[model samples]
Target: MANTPSAKKAARKIARRTLINKTRRSRVRTFLRKVEEAILSGDHEAARAAFKVAEPELARAAAKGVIHKNTASRKISRLSSRVKAVGAA
Candidate 1:
């Protein structure tokens, strides 16, 4: 529990930031899901397109501090690999 006025205000700010971060994280997940679906469905073109859209969303999320930069880069790398393999297959 926050006792001082400043502490209470800080708590409120944390709560607000939590909600915003949750939404940002959820948005990133939604984009990732789209890419995964496209990949799973074996549509290379769609997968590539979805990846195109998802890549920037991931980068933006990392930039906004919703996710770590390395995490975003790793996900992008893995997805790009899968997309390339899909094309090869």
Candidate 2:
């Protein structure tokens, strides 16, 4: 429970921020899923295109603090490798 007025306001702010962050996270996941689906379906061009879109989304989410910087980097690295392999195959 928030006792002070300031605390109550902060709680409200936090709730709003939480919703925004959740939205951002979901958007990022959707983009990643698109890439994964393209990869699994063996569409190299689609996968590469999805990755291109997802990379910037992931970077933006990280920049906004929705996810960790290292986490975003790791995902980008792994996905890039998989996308490259798809192209090679």
Residue 14's lDDT in candidate 2: 100
> What TM-score does candidate 1 get on C-alpha atoms?
0.97
lDDT of 2 by residue, 1-89 (tens): 99999999999999999999999999999999999999999889999999999999999999999999999999999999999999999
Q: Tell me how candidate 1 scores on lDDT.
A: 0.96
Q: Against the hidden reference, what TM-scores do the models get? A: 0.97, 0.99
Worst 10 residues of 1 by lDDT: 80-89
RMSD of each: 0.6, 0.4
Model 1 per-residue lDDT tens digits across residues 1-89: 99999999999999999999999999999999999999998999999999999999999999999999999999999999998988888
